[model samples]
Target: MKTEKRKLAIWMTMEAIEVIGLKRIVLDRDVAEAVGFFHAVIAPQVFATAERFGIHRVDVEETEDGRLPG
Candidate 1:
């Protein structure tokens, strides 16, 4: 089996207390299938719960090499 690169953008921010708000999750075309599979196989409830109680935060970009911006 071969694993493909998944570029996922997750929005996150500090919620009041005891909970971190997980906003919207944008999965690129490469990772859209993976994201669906993950939710279906691993944790289906996560998507629902995230939508219910999470606030949409800022957008984050993902790079393959994981290099810091200079």
Candidate 2:
């Protein structure tokens, strides 16, 4: 569960760069805070809620270069 949340937080943080417009906009402090909170807080809640919906997957599939697959 801890590992899964950490992994999900990485993916979520990357997505946040675009969704939250954090690319060079917000300070590194914001990124740090967001990542930590996502992993420690949001990720757990997400997984708990997901189980109710039959969703158990937490890993993200990516290419060798770390890019999201199409």
Candidate 3:
């Protein structure tokens, strides 16, 4: 028997206060790496907004293709 490898991608959406509004980001990485990237790169800024402009929501989706349907 043979197996095939598949590519994975991560889609993230964040809603912040009035200033930031809504932001969407995409990463071509596996779930673990994508989460790590978010913690390392995006989380700090998001946490900073927690005082006044808190984050409304954060969504993470995994897809074979790094894109949403048109």
Candidate 4:
């Protein structure tokens, strides 16, 4: 089988992430695309959680690797 490369974006924050208790998240868009469904492990809003992690400001960026190295 061949794999196609793809990217996905999900809204999340440092404090609210404990709801699902996921220590890590991995992107597997190829399977997700083919299956036509996927679930995001984190919440898509940072409205209240940011302050708990000392996040004064949140900067958004476009990325390829899906890792927050930048």
Query: Which candidate's TM-score is highest?
Result: 2
C-alpha RMSD values across all candidates: 15.5, 12.5, 14.9, 13.6
Q: How far out, in Å, is residue 12 in model 1? A: 21
lDDT of each: 0.40, 0.51, 0.45, 0.39
Highest lDDT against the true fold, candidate: 2
TM-score against native, each model: 0.21, 0.41, 0.33, 0.21
lDDT of 1 at 13: 37
At residue 59, give the lDDT of candidate 1.
20
Model 2: residue 41 alpha-carbon error in angstroms = 0.7
Which of 2 and 3 is the better model by lDDT? 2
Q: What is candidate 4's lDDT per residue for 3-66, written digit by digit as tens?
A: 9865534455445544323322224335544222222323234424555556553333443553
Model 4 accuracy (lDDT, Cα): 0.39
Candidate with the larger lDDT of 1 and 2: 2
- Which residue pairs clash within candidate 3? none
Write the residue-wise lDDT of candidate 3 on 1-70 in tens digits.
8988754334435445411321222333356655565665566555455434543434234435633222
In order of listing, the candidates' clash counts read: 0, 0, 0, 0
The worst-scoring run of ten residues by lDDT in candidate 4 lies at 34-43
TM-score of model 2 (CA atoms): 0.41
How far residue 52's Cα lies from its native spot in candidate 2, in Å, is 1.2
Q: lDDT, candidate 2, residue 65?
A: 55
